[model samples]
Target chain A: MTELEFDYLRAYLKQRSGLALTPEKRYLVESRLTPVCRRFGLATLRDLVGTLKVARDSAIEKAVVEAMTTNETFFFRDRTPFDLFRDVLLPQAMARRAGQRRLRIWCAAASTGQEPYSLAILLQEAGVKLAGWQVEIVATDLSTEVIEKGKLGLYSHFEVQRGLPVQWLLKYFTQIGEQWQIAPSLRSMVDYRPLNLLNGFEALGTFDVIYCRNVLIYFDTPTKADILGRLADRLGPEGALLLGAAETVIGLTDRLSPNPQHRGLYGVAAPVVRAASPVAPPVSQLRVAAR
Target chain B: MTNDPAETRTCLVVDDSAVIRKVARRIIETLGFAVTEAEDGSDALLRCAEAMPDVILLDWNMPNVDGYAFLQALRQRPGGTGPKILFCTTENDVGAIARALRAGADEYIMKPFDRDILTAKLEQVGVVQADAA
Candidate 1:
């Protein structure tokens, strides 16, 4: 692909999906988009890009976004996080929110629903007190196609076998022909939506825990800061943020701070205020005066 | 008489993938034995508890509880109605197969299996009769 075409595709993808493709990712673009070019009956990728530039059709743009969005996920991916959630996070959240009769979690970039469903299965294993709590999990992805597939809750045999625990699989999925359909009870727990992080997110509402793992590496630094800021704004006072083990926001944002108890886990830090207060007398002076 | 496929010995196919389980079920049924399925080792163990099978076609990989763990647990069960297990998986390292056999696997079959090969192997393990239809 020509530099101009690469720039056009990259810029369009940056605008549509929050992913900022680097120069090294050129091959990825070529391999992934070649079929798109063929499907559009364009002679070349350049021709496809040219058509996309003037294409007024929403379907074409949707197709481009869908193709660009990465849907890399497996059941119970990166075992440690799920282990921490079960062993540490959920218990902490439950204890802290004991007074409230509800809990809300958001899996941003849920990517075919593995992460959220994993959480649901964990919650189910944790037992019945959770049943009384009004739990609502919102799973969002940039790709409408992936979101629809997540809602369908059907996975090919190999897909479910990847990281899914056997007992949970037998309990939560039913074999329909060659596909495993997630049980209705577990499927009902998650609400999936198509959300572009580049756009405004006031409509998403606040969440107690936001899992935006393995997504920030795709964006530019500025985009990462912007997305994290928005995520912070949507986080409740005591809400926590979980990222991929390789991802961190330590220097990226002042809005979130690393949780002292857990690595790669962040919490919405209390905002700084510059309001002035009259200084109290020194402790030594007070002791002398009392004498 | 011992090799007769008409003996109708039950076999449990344990795999997290519905597709693999279905394929294994079809192959096992074609070999003239009844088949049951479990998505993981834990479920497989529970099913074994309810009704002990004559043989188990166990996948080597699964999330949460895996194949090796299930095999160990199965061997630990008392009263010794122990099912003869065949390791069915994609990992075909000869050393791995040897280790599985050491761990009490009666046979090992690599995945993307041929139906005829599986039937012949089952017959060799004495789980089915070679001539019984």
Candidate 2:
């Protein structure tokens, strides 16, 4: 890919998906788009870009973004988050919501449903602890392919072994052949849908707990902070936000602050600033504000 | 028959071929779950009656009670919860996958699967939440 072509592709990804690809990502762009080129029978990246120029929602457009968006994930991925979730966050959230008796969670970048299903199993393990509370988990990903897979709640034998314990394996999953599937009740606990975090997902309603992990690393600083700001607006007063272990609320936005008791967890600070710019108001636009 | 959480969970591997059983057995045991082998569907059913494994890696086209037949019968067993059944097939036919789903199979696997494929399918079926605990 020429410098000129790389520049255009970078701009296209930003405009179309709010992803900011740095100059170092030149090889990444080439490798990701190479397959798309072969599939469309285009000889060069330039030709692929040319085809994308004409139509919105073109097949090429979808394929390009799907290729760029990383879908790597597994059940309970990092141990800390799930541990905090079941042992500390969940029980506390349950207690805090006892008066209302309802809970809603959103898993941004849900990939193929491992994260959400993991949450379901925890809730299931809690059993009677959640006796009367109504619960809903919304798992969203930019890739329709993974979203569809998430809906099926199927994983290869490999997926089940990673981070998932044998006990949960027995309790929550049933073997089909060489693959395993989430139990019907657990699968139904989550609603997986096509969502791009850049589009802003507040329309799904405020959530008590939002797990948006390992997704912020893809964007530039402005996009990262902007997404964090929008996420702040979506948290219920009693809610907490769980980010990837490597992620932080520090310096991103004044609306969310690091929780004293948790390393990677953030909570809404009082007097939510709601992004200093016109997020598009009542709340200003969720899109990044002009500098 | 065991309810002890610390007791290694059981995986009943049913395949007529001794070689496939050995290969699957090594992988499943390495996964830390106890492995039981059955040469065909009849043996598999008898083993299952004695104990409902956490996960069952079933093979289609077995003698006497085939994978589909075992699946249909297994689902009908009166119980608290039946074992999660994953039907293994040598064919990559879409029709076969659809049939497995219809037969109340929890998931499916193809022949010559390695540790990764088996692990992923097991996680998908929830017989193992390696990430959760």
Error of 2 at A151 (Å): 0.3
Residue A195 of model 1, lDDT score: 86
Clashing pairs in 1: B3-B129, B4-B129, B5-B129
- B1-133 in candidate 2: lDDT tens per residue? 3334587789999888899999999988877788898888889878888888888999898778888887777777865146888778785444666777777777777776787667767766766663422
lDDT, each prediction: 0.82, 0.82
lDDT (Cα) of model 1: 0.82
Q: What tens digits encode model 1's per-residue C-alpha lDDT throughout A79-198?
A: 667777888878888888889967889999898888999999988887786868988899998888898899989987567665664446566888776677898988999999888888
- Error in Å for residue A152 of model 2: 0.3
For candidate 1, what is the DockQ-based docking class? incorrect
Winning model by TM-score: 1
Go through the candidates in order and give the clash count of each: 3, 47
